[model samples]
Target: MTRRPSLAGRLSRALAACVALALIVMVVASTLVMRSWMLANMDSELHRLSQRAGERLDVEDAPDDEVDTDDDSNEESDDDSDDDSDDDGARTTLQSSGRAPRPGGPLVPGGPKGHGFGGAGIAEGTLQYVSEDGEAAGAVVSNFSVTYLNAPALAILAAVPADGGMHTVRLKGMGTFRVTARVVEGKTVLVGIPMDSIDDVVLMLVGVEIGLSLVVAIAAGFAGRAWVRRELRPLGVVRAAAADIASRDLADESGNLTRVGEETTAGPVEVADVAGALNSMIDAVEDGMERRARSEAKVRQFVADASHELRTPLASVQGYAQLARRDIGEASRTQALERISSEGARMASLVEEMLTLARLDGNRALTCDRVDVIPVILDALSDAHVVAPDHAWELGEAVDAPVLGDESALRQILTNLLANARVHTPAGTRVVVSVLRSRDEAVAASAAPRGPAKGGGSATGAQASSMITIRVADDGPGIPADIRDRVFDRFVRGDSSRTRDGRGSSGLGMSIVESLARAMGGSVRLVDSEKGTVIDVTLPAA
Candidate 1:
């Protein structure tokens, strides 16, 4: 099968075709106009020649002179008679110039007095005289010595009406002529000129037109192709770039997907727009691939961390079960049972936290309701006091702090932050939870270091809207500087060794807190503090 032509090729061909078509139309129209003009000029010349012949015949028919009898009477006087004779001679010479010679008579090469019948210095042409009854009277032929007045030629000439207008006729011995017949002095005079020169001019003109038209068509095709190519150069560059992109693996992290350069993008608005759009599409695809890679990496780490956390609890439970099955005292059996129960609880909690993270990652919608953050913070403090009494837990200056969120998720956020403080720090660490309503602008302008919220949420319009900020700060060895920025990343733990008081912490507490906060159209960030880590949660107010 023949491959279809490219867009550029098609466009070039179309341009060339249009140019050729227009040139052909102009050439044809101009040729026809020129032909008509030449024919009109030839007809006009024939009519003028015929009219001149009629005028000469009319002059010849007039009386030669008044027959100057005064010349004879004055002959004795030399000066007077000489003057009379000169006058008579001048009149006689003028009459003789108009008269036609008799048929079969000795013909003057030029007419009498050196003037031809048509005009002085004119080319010799066909002339014939006919009687009023349509009989040939006489004829003159010069220049071309073709026999005139054969039977067919006489019939054609006799049939011509004695009108002043010219007509076309074909003579048997000759070719074609434009002739005119008119009555002068009671006789028919026929004047004619050959049409060979007019036919030759028209034929020559046609040949030149054909040759020139071909040259112009060829030139137009080549020139049109070049012009179209130059105009579509930018599109060609875009096409090449697209083909190059197609050949490479876009998902390959190491591959550089180059964009259309400025040189190629510059030109007409339409072409530049296409180039710009192509670049934008490439950038978007590259960005999407990077995000996908990061997502995959996070998934892998999450699976590994979850498995490791489960392994510890499973090992402890297994050991306890084996001890319970051994031949031992009732007291020893009871202790092993208690240890197994504790390990089982720990594993269950770890699994629950993992499930919650998965749900949040899936963007599960939560209960959207107005909840007062102060009450949630107080409840979390009470829980923290119960979980770790050795830690000094307190509630800072509180406010209404009404916000839009799921009550359970909001409570979990507070619980996670407070628990993180309790687990990471030693006993007697004062963990304070503060709830307050603040403007977004004030928080943004503050010099305190901030962390980014992790969910797919935007807070661009929140500057003008109200927000409630909750702070869970503690006097503990703050998160290590090395992992501070990545505190909210999944599987990242403050204690890189993943141990706190000989117990394994799941390390997903802070990550869940940030994800939940972002899901509720809010943000969570770690505030810089000299004494301990300060985690701030900002939520849109109800």
Candidate 2:
């Protein structure tokens, strides 16, 4: 299996990647802007310097007749002997003595005009000028003087256009400069500043940006990871809860209902939601386990009850058969034989009820048709009257409650209910059977509980006026509160408190009624009544 990164790690990586990308973009944009701004300032400076130099050249080199017309200002009439500028704001007019300056000579720019260049922090390679005569001159700030350029440097500057627009060019001996050229008094006047300062500043700025961007990206990664993990701390609580459940011993008889703490719900909404979902799942699992435990307990009780019940009949038949073999005279032998046959018949009846319950529990299919419950009630009442003539069997408040169910199953339900009343109550107890047409809510006890579908499943509130209720009630002592809830459970019989009247019951009677009713899309429930037991069976109306 491919190993996947943790949520925290993956999220941190994404955050870091985004930070790095943003920083890179900023660095590139800033570098370009800074470089562009510096070059613009350099171009402006070069333009101003070139114009100043051209003005001076026009005055010193132009012919006497041409000087006045070419001059932008007549200020060039100052004494030629004082060829330098000073702090008094005077600008210089260079002569160069019409020849190249000697190496290490007195500073030619030392006069008021040239001294103007000395202050103001003007440095070596800060200014250079190439004239029309194929000669080059440059200021060496360090030496506080001006010197002629070698032939190669002069040749490079001479090639510059005199259009007065700024340009960058590398000099043959004096490094690179941004320069402009123009004709001044029949001589090409070139003036420029070197490019070294701008290059150094821009380089340092780029270096700083790259280093800062990397630091920010790395810092973002670590900080983001911790924040995300704290926000999702609830997830760890949920995981621990799950692990605790998993570590349990969930055997057949074990019942553990451990749960996660409320702290697990404290976090971001998404984390809280996940923790809440886990709690819900745990609740469902606990409910299922509880049901399973009950079912298992019921099964054990059922097996023991069945064995005890069958053992009684088998022992009786065996004992009587042995007695008959003794030949204790004809009447006694006949009585033993009869007793054996009677016990056999009772056992057969019990087995039949058991088998019927098994098939009903299996959800056996039934053929359904409209059944008028009044007729079935009357027929079952007549039979109960015959079985226990001492009991007062009567029909009460009858209605034409037609239901869609198996006729035989409907008859069986009423028979079982009447039998329970007859056998459990006193001989003179009044048993009344009633029928009514009712709404689903009024008779919804007949509808099956919702779960995995049994065909079309149970009735709903939308099925208004769709239920037929048949109630079998008696005026005998009511069932004890303790066993009333479980009266319909298989093999669960009540004590004498319900006036069971010393009668024996298989206890499967009510369970059978319940199963058959539910199988036919109906339900059975015991109602709280003023007196005696009131068992109501509801079915879907035809």
Candidate 3:
């Protein structure tokens, strides 16, 4: 795959392109304006020269001056005499300053005489004129000398329409000129000015503009790149943080958290906003990973504890089976068989509890129905009395609190709570089972934030005063204080001993109770009691 260019590079290119385009437009407009101004100045000068030439032409009215034009030498002599003895004594004379006019290219200057009249703009340039008829013309070099090249030059000038509008034309030997025609009396006189000066100035202006534009554009490109990179520095820090997270060994469950610091989150508002979101995302990921690590640890402990639990019953069943095989006597064999059967039943119960907890953790949806928890509480109390008659079991405040839950799960929850009380307490412990409405407040008819479906979380409307609370309390030695906080954790019991009351009580009983309660959108908690264990199970009212 082709790698894309960086943002800095693209932005720099765009900035340079914009700068260059603007400069080009400005340069083009200025160049055109300059050329137009130069042309206008040339036109004005050409018109002034042509008008002066026409005024001079009307001085030569003698029939001899017109006839002598056929001879170049005689024409020059007549022109000198006419210029020296002008009829008005104020003759409008024309002259060349430096270069002599080309051979057959004389009698062209139309300005009045002298170095004082010709400045830097017109000095050393040729001035040409055409007669009224198409056949005659004259030129004068800047030295006040007259010459003739009237054959082709006169024909080129004769084409001028005397419209006073300037037009450009090139002569055979002379350079390009801006020429115009002015009619005086009945004759047409043409004036021509060279185009070299204007062209040189315009060319230089265009050349300088192109060079300057390139220099400025290149500078802008470099500066823009640096600026863009500077502004994006915070983003680079964020990327490094992400990369550090991505490269970590998350599968190993090490739970080393990662995050970008305040420096990375500090920048322009736009970048800062994105960085803030990035930090939040990092926090979420770290939390999830930490939870996963804790879950894995719990899974390992569960497996080990399960192995220990099943091993005892298996060993007992094996030992009893071996004893029955020996046949010490018929009565002894019969006792071994009964013992094996009891152990097998206990193993089956443990396995079933594990399966139920697993299903609840998997978030399997159960049949929800309105369950009258009062009967369930009484049933649990009766069963507890029959099993542990030495303990006084009674129902306390059995209210008409019907709850929305799976009935079987609710029975199992109550059964587990009562069983815990019976198994852990001494022979004379007083146990009370209660089903009462929540006293906090009425539940709002709206959804609320919840946790995993299995356990350890409350559902929406959990705080409603109308909720059902099933609390099983026993007046006996309370739970060990150090383990009270985690009493509901799997395999936790009042005592660490594997067997209780000569029976293996699967520690999963409380865990299952919590899981089932939460799966039904309820929650269970171990309440702090002064001298005994008290557990409260709260469920949403139907």
TM-score of each: 0.74, 0.76, 0.75
Residues 177-214, candidate 1: write the lDDT tens digits: 77788887776777777776767876787678767777
On residues 369-439, what C-alpha lDDT tens digit does candidate 3 reach at each position? 99988887778778878878899998887888699989999989988888888888889999988887766
Please report, in order, the local distance difference test score of every candidate based on alpha carbons.
0.69, 0.71, 0.71
lDDT for 480 (candidate 1): 91
Scored by lDDT, model 2 comes in at: 0.71
How good is model 1 by TM-score?
0.74
Instruction: After superposing candidate 3 on the true structure, give the runs of residues whose Cα lies further than 4 Å from its correct spot.
Output: 1-14, 40-54, 57-161, 166-176, 179-192, 229-261, 268-285, 385-394, 398-401, 427-430, 441-467, 500-504
Global CA lDDT of candidate 3, please?
0.71
- Predicted candidate 2 versus true structure: per-residue lDDT over 399-482, tens digit per residue: 775889999999889889998898778779999999876543643433554221223233353254778778889999877777
Better of 1 and 3 by TM-score: 3
Alpha-carbon runs more than 4 Å astray in model 1: 6-12, 43-47, 57-196, 223-254, 258-263, 266-282, 389-401, 440-461, 496-504
Tell me the lDDT of model 1 at 72: 28
lDDT of 1 at 11: 70
